[model samples]
Target: MSNSEPQRQATVADSQAITVQTEHGLYIDPQALSAHLPALSYRDNELYIEDVSVSGLAKQYDTPCYVYSKQAILDVYQAYSDSFASLEHQICYAVKANSNLAVLGILAQAGAGFDIVSRGELMRVLAAGGQAGRVVYSGVGKTYSDIEFALQQGIGCFNVESISELSLINEVADQLDTPAPISLRVNPDVDAKTHPYISTGLKDNKFGIAHEQALDVYAQAAAMSHIEIVGIDCHIGSQLTEVAPFVAALDKVIELVQALADQGITLKHVDLGGGLGVRYIDESPVSIADFADALLPKLTELGLKVFFEPGRSMVANAGVLLTRVDVLKPTEHKNFAIVDAAMNDLIRPALYQAEMAVIPQQLPNGGMQADDTKTWDIVGAICETGDFLAKDRVLALAEGDILAITGAGAYGFTMSSNYNSRPRASEVMVAQSQQQLIRKRETIEDLYRDEMRWQDQ
Candidate 1:
C-alpha cells in the first residue's frame, strides 16, 4: 500500500469477516503501545511491563488481573515532587482513583499524602500506613460519624463544600471541644471543558460553594467558635487535558484569595485541586512540569503552601488490565473479540465511553501478514451491550491470546463491581523483574460472603 493510502480500510472476506488493512506491514507496531506507556515494551516479539513478561503474568496469575509497575508509580510521584520542589507543597494522592491497599502503601512509603472522600477511605489510608495528619477529607456527603471519626483521627483538613457542611463541622467540633481545620471548596464557575459527569467547579455542578458567596462563607466560618479557616480549595473537574482551564480557574481563585485576605481572613494555604489528564489514546495532555510551570508563579506570589490532589495522572499509565481472549466471533458487519475481563472489572469504557488501547501480549506465531489483521470490537463476557473495552481496533488477534488494556492503573480496580455475580480480578504489582500478588482474585462464595440464606432466616 502507498504511504498516502489510509492505514485502516474495511472490507468483507470469504468468511464474511470485517478485515482492516494495516498501515504498511502485517503485525501491529509494538511502538504504538510503548510510546505512551514508557514502562511497557516488546522484547523478542513478546510484550513486557518493566522487566516481567506480560504472558508470564497471565500464566502464573490467571487472566483478568490488574498488573501495576511499582517503579512507574514512584517515577510519576517523584516527577510531581521534583516539578514543585521550589515551593512548599503537598501531593495528596486521590484515593478514589486507585484505593488498593498496596497502591496506597506504595505512595505512602514514598512520602505522599492522601485525599479521601469518606471515613472508609481514611481507614484505608491508615491501614496502609499513611499518617492521619497528612490525610485531607473531601466529598460533599460527610456524615456525622465521618466528621467525628476524621476529627478524632486528627486529619489534616476538611475541604468543606457547602454552608450546611460548615455548620455541621462546627457543631461536631464544638461538641468535641476542638477546632476543626477547614478550607472552603470554592466553585469558581470556570468550565474545565472535560466530561460532564466529572465536571465540578461549574455553577450547575453540586461541588463547592458559589464564587459570589465564597467571601461571605469565609466570614461565616470565621465567626464560628470551632471553625478554623486554614485554606481555600477549588477543583473544577477531572481528566482535564489543557492547562488553560486550570489557569483560568486559578485566576478566579486568586481573586477570591486576595478578597479573603483583604477582609482580614488571611489563609495559610491554597489547594489548586488536581484534574491533569493522561494519554489514554491520542490525547496530548499537559506534562506535570508544564502544568506546574503554568500555575506555580501565581502560587508563589500567594506565598502560601500549595496542595495538589492528583489521582488519575499518578497511576493511570502505570498499570494495565491483563485479559484473555476467550472467543472470536466474526460477522459481516463487525467482529467481536470476547475477553474474560468485563465492565465489572474495568468500567471506564462503559461509564465514561472511554476508548482504551488494547494490544496483544505476544505476536502471532511466525509473525502475522496483512490478511491476518481484522477489525475487532473488544467486548467482555458481561450480558450488557455496553460491556466493551475498545471499539473498532484493528489488530491481529486469536483465541486464548492475552491482551493488555493500557492506561488502567487509576480508577480501574477501584471502580470495579460484582455485577453479574462475577468475582473481582486479582491485582499484581511488578518492580523490575519481581512480581508480587497484592490482591487475590475473589471467589464465587465471596460474592455472597455476607448475605444470609432466606431459609435460615
Candidate 2:
C-alpha cells in the first residue's frame, strides 16, 4: 500500500509480517459495511462474505478466482421480488448473461423463472429444476431446432423478434403438433443510454420487431392455429440507469398492446425485458421500488401479467473476481501492478470502458486512503498490450497485495476464456461461512480434450 516502501515479493511472507489483532483490545468497527456492492461486505480491513473469509477463500481456491457470496444472490433476487411483490410480475432470470448451472440452480431453488435465448439455455433452466412452464425463450434468430426444443419443453412463451421468426415458430410447432405460445418483442425505439453493442430496444438494433409491425404480427399469429398470441416483450438495453427511457418504452408497448386488442387479438402477458442498471462507478441505481413505482401503475392500468428478464441487476455485485498481484514495475511515467488475471478473465473494463472500484486487501492506512497524490495502473498478466483492468487507479497498491474487483458477479467469469492457452480460473461460492468450488480450474488436458490430431481428408 505504501508507494515509498520497497516492492516486496507477492507471497505469504508479506502476509506474515503483519501484526495480529488482539481479541481483548480489538473491537469490531460498528460502522463497517461491505463495499455496498449488492450484498458484499468489506469490514475490518477484510472481506467477511456470507460468513466466509475473503482472503481464506483465495488461499483455498487460488488467484484470479471468482468468489460469490451465496447470500448476495438471494438478497438481489429478493430485492426485485419484494419490489413487485404487491404486483403480479414474474422475475425471469436471463440465463445467457450468467448460465453457470450452479448459479441458475440456486435461483431456481429460490423459486425464480428464466428468460432463455437458446434451446441450450432452456435446457439448462430445465436441468436446474426450472419449470418449462415458467421459462420464456427469447432470441432474434431462433433456428428450427431451437423452436422445436422450446415447443417440446412447453416454455411460457417465445419472444418473437420478427414476423419471419413467428412464421418459423408456427411451422416448427405445426410440424411437432404443438401450440407454441409467443410474445412479440416490439422495438419502441427508446434510447436506453447504454453501450452501443448491448442496447436492444432501439429500432436500429437487430433485436426485437419494429414497433409499427408488432400489431399486425400479433394479429396474424392469433389467426395461425400453431402459434398462440400470448404476450408482448422488449429489452431496452443493458446497464441503463435512467427510469425515463423504461417509462417511455412501457407507454410505447402498452399503446401497441391496445392497438392489437382493437383487432381482437388480446395478449395474456407482457414481458418487459429487463435492462435495469446497477451502480458500477459513481452513478447510483434507481431502487427497485422506484422502478415499480414508475412502471407498475401503467402495467396495472393495462391489466396484464408482467414479466422481467433481469440479468445484470440481480447478479452483478453478488460476486467479486479476487486476484493476486503477480508482479510490479514502476516506470517514470506510471506504476503498473500486474496481476495474474487478464482481459480474458474479466473484459468489462477493456470492452465497455467499465470502471470497477479497485480495493487492495490492505493499504498503508488499513484500507483507508484519501490521498490525491498517488496513482497506479492495475493491469493483468496477458499477452495483449490492451489487457489493462483499471486505468489511473487511485489505490496506493504494492506488488503483493490482493485486489478485489467489485461488481463482477454477472458478466465477469461467464465472458472469460482460455486465451493465450492460460488456464481458465475457478469459481467458488460462500454461504454461511462454507466455501464450495462451483466451477473447477481448467487444466491443459481439459482444454485439449475436445481437440484431436487428424490427417487431412
lDDT of 2 by residue, 1-457 (tens): 3333223222212222121112211111111214345545555656656677777877888888888777888787888898888667788998877888788999999989899888888888888889999998888878998888778877788888888898898999889998888888889999998889888877789998888877767778888879888898988899888789999999998898888888888889888889888866445668778988898778888888889999988888788888888787878777788999889899988999887766655434443334422456778878787898887654555666788787888889888988888888898887886888989999888888999899899
**Tens-digit lDDT string for candidate 1 (1-457):** 2223224332422232123345432223445547557689988888999999998999999989999999999998999999999999999999999999999998999999999999999999999999988988899999999999999999999999999999999999999999999999999999998989999989999999999999999999999999999999999999998899999988998999899888999888889889899987656788999999998888888899999999999999999999999999987777899999999999999899987778788876676565667777889999999999888776778899999998999999999999999999999999999999999999999999899878953
Question: Which segments of model 1 are wrong by more than 4 Å?
Answer: 1-28, 365-368
Q: After TM-score superposition, what is the CA distance of residue 189 in candidate 1 from its true location, in Å? A: 0.9
Alpha-carbon TM-score of each model against the true structure:
0.94, 0.90
Top-scoring candidate (TM-score): 1
Report the C-alpha displacement of residue 150, candidate 1, in angstroms.
Answer: 0.2
The best candidate by lDDT is 1
